[model samples]
Target: SVSVLSYAVIFAASTKLDITRKDSIKFICTFAILELVIELLYISYYERKKMISLLKGEK
Candidate 1:
């Protein structure tokens, strides 16, 4: 995924800088978690109509 790739790039860049190892890991993990939550909400919202029709037995 683009997010994973971007996180990889960010981690690599951060490691190259003077930032501590723990901070870089923390930053990457935070972004990854936020992305996951956002994607889940977005998927549920966009698929709400389809889910409702299926629940009602619509074709």
Candidate 2:
């Protein structure tokens, strides 16, 4: 889950120059969603690695 304040900051920064509500909302939503997906993928990879290590008795 992306932090709310971070999302707001992102939304604010993107629209600070243009002052357009639509553009800012679009940019923020896209970025936040992408970041959330990437974080989930990273977590999945780490969990899988841990499981593999445990199976091999290396941890």
Clashes of each: 0, 0
Worst 10 residues of 1 by lDDT: 1-10
For model 2, the local distance difference test gives: 0.85
Candidate 2 similarity to native, TM-score: 0.77
Q: Give the whole-model CA lDDT for all candidates, comma-separated.
A: 0.90, 0.85
lDDT of 1 at 29: 88
Clash pairs, candidate 1, are: none
- Listed per candidate, the RMSD to the true structure in angstroms reads 2.6, 2.2
Please give the distance, in angstroms, between residue 45's alpha carbon in candidate 2 and its true position after superposition: 0.7
Task: Find the candidate with the highest lDDT and give its number.
Answer: 1
Which segments of candidate 2 are over 4 A away from where they belong? Answer: none
Question: Candidate 2's error at 22, in angstroms?
Answer: 1.2
